[model samples]
Target: MKLINLISPSANLAELTALASDDDLLLLRQDAVYLVYQAALPFPGKVLALESDINWRNITLPAHIRAITDAEWVTLSANASQNLLWS
Candidate 1:
């Protein structure tokens, strides 16, 4: 089953990423985007950043995480058998 992890904030991103499987995807939102910007987390699977969030903060999209639209986020979540939210 494909699992999507939503990383928000108020948690240890490194530890959370460590628990991820190679097949799991990471969706960086809110403050979690900072980690990717800093090149902190080398998640095994695909990494996506919420487009609106990044733009709202006036941050340039990092190479490590692709920006996804709200519609795409819905599709991604729908395709995943499991979704984990961390904040």
Candidate 2:
């Protein structure tokens, strides 16, 4: 599994699309948490946002996109075969 971390709002969409796979996990953190408001997403797989970031930004993610805690983020990172950053 791949862990794709998007740390900024200006992340390259083309690069993300080229790298993303169905088994990848997309993590929205920092300024990237604002991406949840977009109607279309670059990654088609599971999406997770930092709970703290989401709360800080007051973003309400769609049901399909989950808000994960710091521990959960660490667990995902530990379990993934590959880790990628979009920003």
lDDT of 2 by residue, 5-82 (tens): 999988887788787889889999999999888887868688899999999988888988999999999999999999
Which prediction has the highest TM-score against the true structure? 2
Q: Give the TM-score of candidate 1.
A: 0.81
Predicted structure with the largest lDDT when compared to the true one: 2
Clash totals for all candidate models: 0, 0
CA RMSD for every model?
A: 2.0, 1.0
Tens-place lDDT digits, model 1, residues 9-56: 557767776778787888888876665656556567878888988888
Give the local distance difference test score of model 1: 0.75
Model 1 alpha-carbon drift over 4 Å, by segment = 1-10
Worst 10 residues of 1 by lDDT: 1-10
The lDDT values for all models are 0.75, 0.89
TM-score of every candidate relative to the true structure: 0.81, 0.93
